[model samples]
Target: MKGLLPPPGAVRLLSIGGLVRTTGFGIMTSISVLYFTRSVGLSAAQVGIGLTIAGGCGIAASVISGRVADAVGARNTAITLVLIQSLAVCGYAFVTSFTGFVIAVSVVLSCHSAAEAARGALVAGLIPAEGRVRARAYLHSVTNAGLSIGAVSGGVALQADTQGVYVGLILACGALFASSGLLYMLLPQVEPVAAPSGRGSWEVWRDRPFLLFAGLNAILAANDTVLVVVLPIWIAQQTEAPLAVFSVVLIFNTLMVVLFQVRASKTTSDIPGGARAMRRSGVLFAVCFALWAFASGQPAWLAVVALLAGAVVHTLGELLWGAGAWTLAYEMAPDHAQGQYQGVFTMSTQLETMVMPVAGTMLILPAGSLGWLLFALLLLVAGLAAPAVARRHTNRHTNRQGTPSWN
Candidate 1:
């Protein structure tokens, strides 16, 4: 409240709703895989395949729904999607077979994915252009805080390990979504800005520069998966440190995002500044992962030390990357096509999360030290590439408008 967030209004309402939605999502994420395998009797392969296909379908839904948002209004579209998300998530409780599970997964994934883009469009429409990045950062901070809360609740339920606990968690997630949807409905809808006449999703597809930028951003987004999927395996199998140390890594990451994301966004509030931040973030990630590689094969004490230190460094990279990404996303999109653009950008995240687990684990965990060093090199390349890419977009904007657009 005392920091950089926009004052209480649409921004705050959206943030609160986002918080509730994310909390629900966090709870589901913590146990969903386990529930599918244990309670529903699905094999791991089936679960993975189901989720992957669902995510792929969600990408298409995201692209299409952006146009729907632009037509129906972002606020209204977001509310409908969230409400549908609630019903879909609740439906998970009744799924007794793989087919039912896949259907439920598809509905939840697509609705949530589309809802996020629509909500972003709503923010772009309602908040002043200059304040959009801060508002986004503030919402992200709320997301991190809510995730922490949900994770703790989920952990308790997991420890209890009762059918009732699992059902309760699933139902609670649905309730949270419903509540968020209601809150979304209460928020004022901004007047729609029509896309240039005759333009539609095809125009979005033809935006080569934005597509390239989104692809690059997706590569950078892999850094997020590295913190979650890759690190635990590395610690459990490759290092002598207690697995409990992994909890510290998660706590550190969450705390950093909650406390510093807004402050970090302030420094990268413009496109050029965000480009710089992205460059710096790459170096930070490279160093952090390099440190993680060093932690391997060390004694338990040394491994813990390295892991903790690397987590702190990794969190720095995460903060910078997140801040810069948010700024660039808002800055690059056209005023009238924010929904479509945001949808396209959201696909980058979807792609990263879907692909990064296999790439990071197979690529980084096998070769050990060399793998990590190579991974760092990849980050460095992406980091170096971002500034130039951003500059090109800026130059193109200047050429079209007779001045830089982000300013």
Candidate 2:
């Protein structure tokens, strides 16, 4: 509720650019795999393996890109990454072989991940600390709206189910990425800041507390797999509920995010507040999974109701978790190295996206409802650990003045 209005000039411009980029992102996500396999004639296994490798490359690129942003300037780095993303996407049209497909996708994903790291630096440079997280949350809300539009547009192409339509959509995405890059050109520029004293360009890697925090956030991020990868299967195979429940829940989650992301982001006002939000979110996630587990044996109508209830809880948890993540990732870092710090956080998330589809399915699909419960417990444990870890590691960190902080 805090940031319900459209953001001011900089945030609004950034959101518009972000919207353009995410729409392209949405389009690619919707059709890229299908295009690789169905249109380009690569096998599903090949597409999967290629994408996995691409994701790994993207993760590695984030740290380097963050360093680049700190050296050259974030706006310049972000714009360059977006431009690179456009070219690589266009190259997809030339992919007649699996190798070409891998090469093209790797470039696109790498640029995307790198651009996020650079963009984080850009935002940190442009937006003041007081308004930063809320601005990012607003941009995130806009991003969901753009992605939804793109996904719906991609679905129109999917209905055609022709190679020409798929290729055309990919080309369209390339154009959008180019446009987004131009929009980034419009944002006000800031000079790159130096890394903190006693810190290397790669300080993020050596900051054990930050890594532990990032890892915790990654564990919490597994909630995404619950919705995107596992939930549809659970609806069809585990419950008597119609597959329609999946759509209902997905739509519900999206709507909640668009409406409440800023309100959720308000949790990041301080370290303790963010940690409490994380702890609370874990419980909500656990409750949502438990609700889903209970849905399996229910009659169709009851199962639908239970599933929707679960979605509500999950969405609430997601809001808190995302807000806390933004706050903590930013607050814990020194201002000078925010880009590299953001790069570390982005890499953790990219790592999750690469691994969770297979890993989460392994944990849940094998044992069915029981597996879901076990997954819920894992989330709860992560949530419970939040405050303890924050209290311990954060205490060890000193402010710029050099005395202990987080008191």
After superposition on all C-alphas, the RMSD of every candidate to the true structure, in Å, is 2.2, 2.2
**What is the per-residue lDDT of model 2 for residues 1-407, given as tens digits with 9 covering 90 to 100?**
44566666888888889999999999989998888888889999999899999999999999889888878888999999999999899899889999998899999999999998988888889999877888888887888888999999898779988988888888999999999999989888878786657767677787777888888898899898778888898888889899987988888898889999988887578777778888899999999999999999899999999999999999999999988878778878777888898888888767788888887678788787889899899899988888776776567764334433333
Query: Which candidate ranks first by TM-score, i.e. highest?
Result: 2
Error of 2 at 312 (Å): 0.5
Candidate whose lDDT is highest: 2
Give the runs in model 2 whose Cα sits over 4 Å from its true position.
1-5, 398-407
Q: Cα lDDT of all candidates, in order? A: 0.85, 0.86
TM-score of each: 0.94, 0.95
Q: Can you list the residue pairs that collide in candidate 2?
A: none
Per-residue lDDT for 43-155 in model 1, tens only? Answer: 99999999998988888888777777777789989999999999999898898999999999999999989998888888898989888888888888998988878877788
Give model 1's TM-score versus the native structure: 0.94
Give each model's clash number. Answer: 0, 0
- Model 2 scores worst on lDDT over the 10 consecutive residues at 398-407
